[model samples]
Target chain A: MIASAYAVPSVLVFVTSALLILIGALGVISVRNPVHAALCLIMTLFGVAVAFVAQSADFLAAVQIIVYAGAIVVLFLFVIMFLGVDQRAHIHFEPLVGQRAFAGVGVAITVAGLIALMARSHWVTGAVSVSSKLSNGSGNVKELGTAVFTTYLFAFEATSALLVIAVVGAVLLARRERSTTSEEAPQ
Target chain B: MNVPAAWYLVLAALLFGIGAFGLLTRRSALIMFMCIELMLNAVNLTFVTFARTLSDISGQAIVFFVMVVAAAEVTVGLGIVVSVFRRRSSTSVDELSEMKG
Candidate 1:
């Protein structure tokens, strides 16, 4: 996996993915239009997929692309288009005084904790051997499927039900229904 | 030199920070959605890194499920955003505060 002194494939992949993720995040926040924001999100998704590939999770990378970048982002775009919301509308920027302060403090504490954890821990570096039972490199898909069907079947089914509920709720919310009741007198 | 796990973690942290900053500063609902995606990507990177470091397929499998859920979330979230826009004609989160007293 190592190449020239200055350039390694892994390093290249990591740097590129990291850069794209950072740019996409910045774009998401800085962009004014929802459509553009969704597009930026696509970029971020793509970057993560690349990172997955770099980690030797080829199947996961493919799934990441197909699901998150392809289906999810497209859905987001469809909704943004259907909404027809004005992109140039005036927006208020006043921060909530208490919430903002609280959020800042919370983030600071989390960051400090994470830094301390990183500093205290000794990370081991080596080639990890795969389990003999799962040595075929069918990757996570086979293992996950086995786990899901065998041990976590109930949880999987529950998740499916939850997804169904979400879909039904989304449909109900998005549908435009005609008013059937008499209108109230104008105020 | 080969890419280290630390590099990936640092990148993920940077991306997460950017997402947080965007979430805090942006008034557009669309931008907020994008920031959420950014956060999700950060998590994805962590999953991939762990899978590689451990040489296990389970991390990749977790990434697979995450991708599926992320897709579903985006679809439903966008649908909500569209409906909200249709009702108000605006996508700015600040202006959509109907519960504000």
Candidate 2:
């Protein structure tokens, strides 16, 4: 009786997020233009952020939007513009012989396997129900901060290191000049 | 009130499959990269769903790291893509098949 406040809104949020995610995913794959696909990817990222919010992981939702949509996708677009790779790619061509056929088979197998596994396992069952771990009577961001800095401190530090290395590597890779024009010629 | 958690899980699975299909079928380096991002997002959905179902906070925390790793991957990957495009002036995997020996 009293839970409807939570239930009804959650149901609405869930439906909206799900639809947006599916549509965006399809658009990303089916859209011919790279720019359009990037936009679709943004939609999908936003949809996922909504789903996170619905689940009460408010911190994650925010981070998802900031990091993924704001930074990552923007980086993708920057690279696309810089490389001029936004020109239409050979979407129809299968680089490897019979790869499309193989991909089709792989998709079927993966879908069937996932469905069967989920049906057989109790992992999805309502075991513990939703808890306030994210908020923990304080605030969403605070709980996340405590968990990350205290319990997952090592992992948090490791991520910082990894990010540093990745940034350096990206800069180095992007800065290197093509050695020889003749070497650039396709064999 | 009982939106079965399985529904979310199933949605994640479907999203993953779609992402995989895109990854396999698409040849554009950028589009393929976008497809990979789709797959990662699907995994994040699954994590959040389980975090809710199991009443655990670790899943969400893990999702944070996943986002971090994904950001790093995009940075490095796009750099490589840019380099390759500069060298060969093409992003098509078939056209960039220089190591097909």
Candidate 3:
């Protein structure tokens, strides 16, 4: 009874989040509407954040919700709305003649290989290593901040530079043609 | 509950496979982009699972970088998608076949 009581909550959370993730994942691929797909992606991201929390990775869980579910998916929806690409897609058509068939075979092979490899080897098994050094009996965010500012400082700074470049490039790519077209129109 | 960490890894693999399948089979560029996001999310799950198993903060830290890169990719990629749609009223990858030689 003691063990069963201990297991109940975690098991329930795990099963709930797992179902959410799987259903959202399938919806992402199977749904014809891009907007719906974006929503499904948000669901998947939330489910991942839940799983991260379950694993005690509080910082990661927060970032997953903030960056992924907050920023990235909203951008997807923005593009979809602006581009008006949310019209129902013709799901039956294939641009490449044998692409769909090849994809099916490749996916089957990949799943089979992964399952075989995972089942046959005990590669992922290991004692749960607590992040006690980093967390240090404090908040997980504090630990994550310390690590980012110390050992991973260079990488963290480099990511900022990369983000700046991406922003500039996106602006240039989106705006360059408009200026050029306007210039030609006045000609 | 003592959910084995291996189960998480298996779940991650399954999600990744589904993402790959969508990436290959879908023709809509937007949906394809969403599929790629799915793949990235799956990778994030894998990283967190390994982090939990190894008791390492580094894996979770790497997930931060991955999220940053993914955000950058989405911004730039969606810009390109919008430009393509502006030029041609369709976001279908098959329709953007102007490069066919």
Find the candidate with the highest DockQ and give its number.
Answer: 3
- For A30-76, candidate 1 gives per-residue lDDT tens digits of 66667777878878878887877666666777777887777777777
For model 2, what is the error of residue B32's alpha carbon versus the real structure, in angstroms, after optimal superposition?
1.0
In Å, residue A82's CA in model 1 sits off its true spot by 1.7
lDDT for B39 in candidate 1 is: 78
Candidate 3 docks at the CAPRI level of medium
Q: What docking tier does model 2 reach?
A: medium
Write the number of the candidate with greater DockQ, choosing between 1 and 2. 2
Model 3 Cα lDDT, one tens digit per residue, B10-82: 7788888889999998888988988898899889888877776666777788888998999999989988887
Select the stronger candidate by DockQ from 2 and 3: 3
Can you rank all candidates by lDDT, best first?
Answer: 2, 3, 1
What ranking emerges by TM-score with the best candidate at the front?
A: 3, 2, 1
**lDDT at A72 for candidate 2?**
89
**TM per candidate:** 0.79, 0.87, 0.90
All candidates: DockQ? 0.48, 0.64, 0.65
Q: Taking the tens digit of each residue's C-alpha lDDT, what string does model 2 give over A92-148?
A: 766589887898799979988998899898647654633336454322667667778
Off by over 4 Å in 2: A1-6, A95-98, A125-139, A178-187
Which CAPRI category fits model 1? acceptable
TM-score of 2: 0.87
Candidate 3: Cα lDDT at B98: 80
Provide chain B's TM-score, model 3: 0.94
